[model samples]
Target chain A: MEPFIRLTAVAAPLLTPNINTDVLIRVEPMIKVPKGKLGPYCFEAWRYLPDRSENPDFILNKPAYRSAKILLAGLNFGCGSSREPAVWALADMGFRCIIAPGFGDIFFNNCFQSGMLPIVMPVETVEKLAKLAQSQGDLAPDFTVDLERQVIVTPSGEDIAFRIDALKRRALLDGLDDIGVTLAAKAKIDAFQANDLAQRPWIYRY
Target chain B: MAASTLFEKIWTSHVISDLGDGFALLHVDRHILHDLNAMKSLVELRERGYAVRNPELTIATPDHGVSTLPGRNIDTVPEGAALLRGYLEETRRAGIRSFDMNEDGQGIVHVIGPELGLTQPGTLFVCGDSHTCTHGGLGALGFGTGRSEVIHVLATQSIYQKKPKQMRINFNGTPGKGVTAKDLILYLIGQIGADGGNGHAVEYAGSAINAMSVEGRLTICNLSIEFGAKVGMIGPDDTAYDYLHGRRFSPAGANWDRAIAHWKTLPTDAGAKFDREIDVNVANVGPQITWGTSPQHVISVNDVVPDPATAGDAARRDAMNGALDYMGLTPGQPIAGTPIDWVFIGSCTNSRISDLREAGAIARGRKVKPGVSAWVVPGSQQVKQQAEAEGLHEVFKQAGFEWREPGCSMCLAANGELMPRGQRSVSTTNRNFEGRQGPGARTHLASPSMAAAAAIEGAITDVRKMMV
Candidate 1:
């Protein structure tokens, strides 16, 4: 996992609410495509036309947003399915941060696991940023997401505060392997299990 | 301790250590896996030189990627063969129990867990599939994990989780006849948007929930993820106890008595406070169905499609218009009587023996309408055997509905059993996302009986009309 500190890049605006994981990466490629090679399959339904050509109408396909690393979306982004590959697909497609009004709980957690940042702002705030990105097009100023400071520097040079779980922020900043950290407390876990077994033997008997 | 909700009790009992900032290292009591990511996680664990911490507590099956076609094998779906084979090999290598293809206990992970008594009250269950919340019907704390979390659980048998806020939704009245649990949940999602339950652990309560069968409760909990809640549960009662009394993995003899005593104490105490509360009176909700893409885009069968022009905001109007266009629906047209090309009567949400029987009751002496291709895929091999033993298969077969093997067939179409592009289907699945059945294939989410009625009429017909 790559450590996320600060990133400055163009932001693509896709303001549709309830953009689910199934739409991020469909089931077929999700099963067959291996990790890190899913860039082409990310958002296959909306990214491509009926004939498999790039859908120029899609914001990501537009020349100005082709190299975007930030995504601005609407409510309930990444809802449906616990597929982690949806985050992988977005990462593969070069997106490192997603800004939305809200997110599905599992998807929100999955983002932290993948070293990607999911920022929640007020719906009106996101819409305002999206409008700025859209109205400026090719000349849209690059936005900067500074994780250590917990703020998003908008194109207009305004700093917007955000919040993330402290432990999650620390994990992302250090790119720490969570399992290794948890395994360090094996003694504690073992002790808990031993005590629990005495209290509830039926749990272990099964 | 003052008062505690069932969620708090279960969560506190499973806590290994508090990592602070509302996070805790949770001890996973039961870890379930399926074909999609379990084998890959196990193989990765091996590559990392880690062994499964508690293989005895882990169970696996091949459901997500296997074909449901008759005479199916690992190779039945060519893309899924490698996954099925890897699952068998890895589980065997890791000393984990796996209910393989055609095995008596093999079926969808959520269905088989409770059916085989692997799910119990007061236990914390985790799985790689989101619908693992279905086990919450047994009064367990169940939620889905991502692939990395699966590997973490395999290595440590513990996971880091931030405790969620609690929300108790009370269904205060009895549902009208023909309005099933599926309709109740769909109505809840429709009333509150898709993200209504976001960031909360939901508890279903009140008279309506207490009166439902265990299978109906499972159906209600199975779609919790669809409504943006990762954890949903119902407190266990005599119905749950009776359902698990003699199952394969359930405790017997003295253990059963002790287990019941512990489970009896797992319900919420009087005066327990919740972060939020929602009261629903289900006395008038009809058999609900999705008219457009999202689960929130649902209405009673008697209602007409909503016009995007009435939407409060531009973005919402655009989304509604896009959904209507993809679904091939007119704004003012009735959702009922909309022609459908296919009917799929199975999925994790509604594929138990009871669900099959409901569909069978509607199909007993009727024929599927011409030009409609209908299929009934059971949730598990046990469900299939039980349905067959009860002659439900004959009822469906005689009505021109295919009686296929057990797997998640036509629900997300992972097994290559998808409806063709441009066709519309009435599915007993949890989702109606655009192209969920197939690319350009529209879906109307409904219950098994509703899907069966659509199969007979070749359109979205109100199940109540046939119920009378």
Candidate 2:
């Protein structure tokens, strides 16, 4: 995983709420491919026509947003299913930051594990950014996300401050996954287990 | 201190270390995994040189990627077979208990957890799949986690977490006749859009929930993920205890007494406070169904399809328009009698014996309408066997429905069973997202009985009208 301090990229707006993981990445029958190969299949159902042709109407198919590295999504983005492939697909597709009103809990955690930064801002701010992206028409301008400063800089120099967990910010900056985070408290865990064993032997019987 | 919410009582008790800023290193009582993500996660653990701290507390099963075709061998579904083989191999190497695809106890992780008595009251459980909230029906604090967290739980038997705000949703009054638990939940999601419960653990209380059977409670809890809740639970009562008294994995004798004593204390106290409270009166909630691409885009079976022109905002209007286009529905058209190509009555949400029985009763003397295909995929082998022994399968087969094996089939469309592109279906599954069943496959989420009634009518017909 790569540490994320700051990222500047064109923002693609998916203005729909509850864009679930199942849509972000189709539930794959063949999940055995290399991690990097998932980018092509991101949003497969919406990205492609029935005849296997690209759906040109999709935002990602537009010439300007084709290289987008930031996603300005609506409330409750990545809301259903716990597939980590959703994060893998987004990250593998070159998205570095996702700005939304909120996110599904598991998907938010998966983003950190995959080196993607998820920033939660007020819904009004996200709507403003989304409107700005729309006004750009075919040539969406790049936005800058600064994790250390907890702010998003719009094309017009408007700064949108976002709130993220301090611990999550540290994880993103350090590129530390949950394993690394949990293992940091290993000594405390062991001591708690010893105390639990002495006090509640029957609890572990099952 | 004032009385604590049921969520705080169970969650705070499991905290081994409190990290600053509302986060904690909480102990996990049981961890469950399934085929889709388990194989890769187990391999990662092995490569990290971290042995599973306690294999006894972990269990894996083949559910997501297996065929629901009767007498089907793993080779029948090649991709599914490969995934199952990987899970089998990895579980063996990791020394974790795995319920093989052919085993009687093997089923969807959520179904098997309760059937095998692994999901006891007041415990913390995590799974790789989002619907792990299904176990919260047992009064447990259960939620989904990511792959890294699953591996972390495997290595240390604990996962880093933050306590979620607690909310309570009370369904008062008796639900009208022919209204199932699925209808109640769908109605709730419709009332409060899909993300209504975001960032909160919800407790389902009131007379309505107390009157439900355990299977009914499970059905309600299974859809908690759809509402964006971290977890949804019903406090354990005699209904729960009676259901678990002599199950295959339940405690016996004096141990049972001790367990019951603790379980009795799992409910909210008289003065417990919740961050949010919602009261729903079920006096008029008809057999509910989704009419659009999202689960929250719901209406009663008798209500007409919503006109996008009535939407309060441009975004909502656009969403409704897109859904109408994808669903091939017209504005102001009645939702009833909307033609459907398939009927699916399975998934963790509604595949238990009681669900099957409801579907079976609806299909008992009626044949499926022409051009409509119906399938009943049981939640587990035990559900399948019980349905067969009770002649439910014979009834379904006689009514032009296929009685399939146990696994998540059309629910995800990941397995071979899928509704064709451009086809419309009435499903008992939790999700109705665009292309959820398959690319361009339109879905109407409903109860099992409703699915059965649709199969017989070849359209989204009202189950209440069909009840005899």
Candidate 3:
């Protein structure tokens, strides 16, 4: 999981701004009990009406979004409660990259840790991309995010740059988290601990 | 250089090591627990056949899943009650101090912790519940944690974590009449858009914060997490010391002298740098309400629901439209005059004695409106007892509001009680999310007095008129 690393070919873009974790996955789908069955319920509630009728109005119900892995959304895409279930539901639903202008802090952290990429583009750009994808009909809409370049290459061959923290980007590229990074430096930490414990006897017990 | 605000003093005392990249391994002094999240860890421990290593460092209470309706044993619901009972049973088995159902000490963990002195200044507090930041109102460093961290804290009494950067939020200008700590927080959350405090500990200073009583400060600090803040604190002054002087666990005599002297040194230094700082002009704040699924979707009572075209960003605009659609609210209507079917005044957020007194003051002689049901629930047993002694319950009953026992009643509909579907309520609780108060039960966040005024008018009414 390199920061902004991972390039994939996408079909028509799906745009939904501020899609709460709730929409990413319904509560029932995540009820993540029964061990690991988190994927199928991604849009359970939205897909069906109260009478279990198929909801034709839902985004996933549309042909374009059904296979669109590249979600181009507006600003503050995930600004709400810190429910990690939303992220799990999104990842399980086959969305790898959520391109938006902003996201809630907790939701953002959850996205990175779960191997999902949240690419933030300005509002003007997201609006342009969304309208283009919406009107393109059968046109193949896609973008490539080169972690090495920190740039998103649109289907029109235009490159859009984004910003990411250097260290987090490194960790994502290396498939590492805070704990993973810490463990990588275990030997150094161990040696430092041995020396520090002798100097500050009360601080180190384990 | 050592201190300029109560926040700096607490941070310095707890800073074990400054790990690189804006993180610290601060010492944790107290860890609190409740039913919903502890179950996750209990399930794991039961699978591995592990025992808790330290019980003295932990505390448990059953507030989230219990029925607030009196005389109904929690066992009525086999699974939910069993899970709650299991939490209490395990806490007892582990020799952890528990404020369980049928125990006088039983109450919301945040409420009782302060009253009983389990929460104190310059200590770190962690809980499985996000609102645990409510403890920070007492000048302690409190935050919520995940299940894995819960296990770590139970096993070693200390969990590994890096510290967050600090922020100072100054509430300048005077809070207009009827503005409260609850309203201040709701307005602040609205301004920050729910995630503005990400990766930071916010400390409130300025005239408005200084004017708030200890209890008022507690209410303001409790909702820090709603804005993604890890900690929210206010400087400990005479007001703080006065609140803690003789609590059940507060240091005695000689130790008290030492503690007070140390507490006096709590405050941010004049030149200390913060990761971020926000200044809210309290003068502009007014009666606030939640119009959407998040606390950030708030506006002053006089303001109208925002049209998507006028929203700050496309995402925000879309969210506003979605919120309006789900809430059945018109875009340009005044929030102040919206009709309400119920008024709820309780929850970990604003269910203290002061909260009740304010509500009771509004309900003193007025009866609830026809077709409207209102509730006046204190946050803890002690709060209830204090309110009862002051005859606040009589005022509520006289005003046609239900006087319920202490429990997390109606805050979440986990208890058998609920607001009927499609009924709108003015609630003093923290959340207005879909079904947070009850399934399809609309909730608008407001101060206790405002809740009382709504109970009387059966609509969202301004409390300034009702204020004595």
Candidate 3 RMSD computed on C-alpha atoms after optimal superposition onto the true structure: 4.7
lDDT of 3 by residue, B117-178 (tens): 77877767887656777887777878766445566556544444545678899999888989
Q: Write the per-residue lDDT of candidate 2 for residues A81-149, one digit (tens) a residue.
A: 988888988887789899898898779878888889988888878888987776355687879999999
Which stretches of candidate 3 lie above 4 Å from their native place? Answer: A1-35, A38-48, A52-54, A67-83, A91-100, A109-206, B1-9, B12-18, B45-53, B155-165, B303-306
lDDT of 3 at A17: 46
* DockQ, candidate no. 3: 0.17
Clashing pairs in 2: none
Q: What is the C-alpha RMSD of each candidate to the true structure, in Å?
A: 1.0, 1.6, 4.7
List TM-score per model, in order.
0.99, 0.97, 0.84
- lDDT string for model 2 (B1-468, tens) is 778777888888789888889998898888988988788888888888777887877888888888988898788788678778888898888788888888988888888988888888888899988998999898989999878888889989998887788889999999887899999999999988888988889999999999999999988888888889979998999999988888877777767888898888778998898999999998879999899988899999999999999987776788889889999999999999888899999999999999999999999989999889999999999898999999999999999999888999899988767778889999999999888888888999999999999999999898888886
- Measured against the true two-chain complex, the DockQ scores of the candidates, in the order shown, are 0.81, 0.65, 0.17
lDDT of 1 by residue, B286-336 (tens): 899999999999999999999999988988999999999999899999899
For residue A176, what is the lDDT in candidate 3?
62
Selected candidate, larger TM-score, 1 vs 2: 1
The CAPRI classification for model 1 reads as: high
